[model samples]
Target: MDKLLITRGVQRSPFWKFILWILPWAMLLAWGLYGAYLCLAEGLNQTNMDNRFAFGLWIYLDLTVIAFGAGAFFTGFLLYILKRHELKSVINSAVVLGLICYSGAIVVLMVDVGQPLRAWFTFWHPNVHSMLTEVTFCLTLYLTVLILEYAPIVMKNRQIRKVPSYLVFEFNLHKLMVVFAGVGAFLSFFHQGSLGGLYGVLRGRPFAFREDLGIWPSTFFLFVLSAMAAGPSFVLLTTWLVEKLSKKRLVKRETMSYLGKLSGVMLIIYILFKSVDTLIWINSTSPSSGFPAFEYYDRAAFGTWVLFAEVVLFGLLPALVLLRKKLRERMVWLIPSAVFVLAGVALNRFVLTIQTLALPTLVFDEFLSYMPSWQEVATFSMVIAYGVLLYSLSFRYLHLFPQERELTQPY
Candidate 1:
């Protein structure tokens, strides 16, 4: 009876319907896999990325997803450390999402690197001063933290729980979850911050350069703050999408509202710091490097609009929208506002990656534009498909939502 009931807990769709739902995503995933093959077999030449733009769409996606994915650690911290009991209702979903985001970013990084087979040379050669090394180290360690945090959820599956030893193991692991969450928080703080530091440390790229605050650049903290601001917003949007697709209330509206409010406050704080950082970069940092601020904007490839789009459209608009009580209460306003927050982060990534490369550092340097080849897009799309597929499977197999059985009482 327990096994039977457990099977029932897994969502049931007609086989044809499941096929229909997954077919398009599956095709896209396959195309991405083919792209991955080309990347591996043919080499890095397959993409538009070059020596100047070594960190292209893949790096942008990795950082943006990981930054947004910080909700996993932050949510875990709230539930396990701070004892915000309300978050327990949605913690599992956060962990699953984090797993997808972090793991997927790692996978993409593996493919994005040249000589992926020799990737370990990063650790072996160890440019200790390089921000990328810190990113690599912390990211991998934090991924372990995420896996550990997620293991108990997998173990809670009725079939798994039925095994007595596994039950005890999971229970023990759950007891130690706070430790794992703490480790995740620690690792997340550094890497998310360091991802921004990656751009900030580029003294050559004045567009990305920032005035140093002690040893770290201002963008370091700004990145972490921006990530925290955007992280919960992404979670809210993802949960809303899941609810729409599944046609069920996964998380209560109150919880969603709380997350939005938190995001709004953080967004405002981040924008303030960002504004300061941008001003400092333009006035003190860029000019010192003998580059005019507006000179970074290319007439053909990048216009001044990128600046307004990132700061105003992506930054202020969503921050203002989500911050308001009346706006947040209205689902119509809130959902798109969360989307704008997402767009802002994505735009942030684009400017950091593409714009940095587009600007000519030397007078002799030529203007450059890069469109991610189909290979790059396909591989990137695979990350989304994989996340969707994993999240779908997790939702079906695990008790992702505590509210599900309570609200629906699936019997």
Candidate 2:
């Protein structure tokens, strides 16, 4: 079965070894499913959320993965639109990663919504004034685009492509890929910005509220830039990890360096704008609302260090490292820089989702903190396990890396 399913000329681990490798992830997935089941069967009571702290770990996960998943649309934009042909080496992998991340985010959101059965209300009764409505529409539409983009890859499998109909279908799908890529990028741009705008429009939460840049707040554009910056780095990191685990050269050194360079250039742009946004908020936005911006960081846990880490340490440091040609070429430096960029994105999401909810908004309100229940942690772990399992299966069966055969074989 493995032999028939595996792509021709691509080396995969023995069937038994492969089974052993996936066993843990499979178990983790099952455990996570059980946790999700409990949440659905029981209710919102299963988690530690309440009226004041409606957003929790699950919301954070949704935002973070969606940001990381930006690789799919951004990579497609680079390859199909910009004519950066070198990106072909990792485009399929990017699509798969995008599918996993976006789908996982939707699943988590379903659970977080509490009334999963009534989730369609967003579409049935739309709210034209809400950023969430835009986010909902764009996320669903972009996910559909990712699925369509991924179809050709799935159809190109060893046994699947043998069928004449499937072969023709894949060939035709290949022709329409650029259109899907364009649509996906368009959808992703709106949703990513809307997610940030969701926080920025929270007038009740001065820590999150920002002055409108025209109609949208500063966070709106900032989120888009951050996602674009983080996307390629995530793709590069995942590709490197796959290479290490499989003990194979999946892509060329130049491809990896190119991804790093792209990420660095975007990161620098994002950081510059982000710094300006922060300064504006501190000097004008928060103060105008009668809340001192620095006072928001007076809490011991949510201190000034978090801002420093997000902006300077994770943000500026990684951008500098990846922009340097010599440093990005080295695996040690490149990998850590990618990690930092991702961390910066995650930290930004955390501050927006968790810290915003945790802080006191009213004059007499006390500082509050909330932690995830076991159910939340398990459900979160489920998404990671799901991504690993899916990527492993895709790598074993699909031609994710175009350069693999040439890099490994003697011509």
Candidate 3:
């Protein structure tokens, strides 16, 4: 069968190496599936999560992926709404990554819920005031937008294009893509913000709670800005990884540089707001609630270092590095800076999810910690494996790099 995602003039490794490339991830996938089986067979008893730690590693991974995946919707908005034609080169890969992240998160969420059988109750019961509900509605709807975004790419396959109906449908979808992109951006903005709202509204946890602006907390806007800041960084990192693994230039240096600039600017802005938010929390919110700022940082594992890393090293440092014209243009500096930018977002999610739970709230409560059981780690590994396999398949089949066919031509 003809491949759908291989680049032009690029020859893949031998069948043996191909098998080797997949073997480890495949094993991880199997382990995750086995864990899922146990979870379904035995229930949440297989994991370490308790009533206090109701949202654990699984939720952390889900929200983090969704936040990073914001590149798809944001990039689409730039390309379709703002008419940023230069972004077209990387848009296809962004869409692919978004589809994988969103779908993978939804899958993990299904397993994470206490009553997996009653998962639909979230929608059916409809807790209108709950932040979780808003997350559910937007996530589900935006996932549809991602699917629509990915459809044309799938249809563009050499073999798939041979089907006339598919070709026609693809063309129609392409024409209407602006509308889909608009809907996706709207949904992404809400869901990404709501993920922050998830922690913000937890008034029971002084560490996570925040003062509201109207109905939503300051973290709500901070999350939206943070996700936007990190989204392009993730896309840049993913593309760089793809280029390294494929041993080909998948996108122009200028395009990567532009994305770096965008991410850097947003990161700087986000850091400023985050700093203000932290000061306000420490001075007003925490004090009013009868908790000192140091009280939350009292945990041995989650100390002041987390804050430093998230704010200074991973946050402001990367922003400074990326914003520089000299550094953004150099591949050596560019790749590592992109990595740092991505790390900052991951750290942000970690502080919000794990740190919030790790901090003792009630006077009788003690600092808590959690390590995912083998079952939990396995389930998480499934997502990584799935992403690798999907990206491999897409790279093997789709024209992800527009310059490929032009760069490698037959005489």
Ranking by lDDT: 2, 3, 1
lDDT of 1 by residue, 154-215 (tens): 88887878999988999999998999988888888899889989888888788888878888
Q: What is candidate 1's TM-score against the reference?
A: 0.94
Off by over 4 Å in 1: 1-12, 409-411
Tens-place lDDT per residue, model 3, 100-149, is 99999998998887467787788899989988899999998999889998
- The local distance difference test score of model 2 is 0.94
Instruction: TM-score each candidate.
Output: 0.94, 0.99, 0.96
Give residue 322's lDDT in candidate 3 (0 to 100). Answer: 90
Model 3 TM: 0.96
Q: Which ten residues in a row have the lowest lDDT in candidate 1?
A: 1-10
* Whole-model lDDT, model 1: 0.84
Candidate 2 Cα outliers beyond 4 Å, as residue runs: none
Best by lDDT: 2
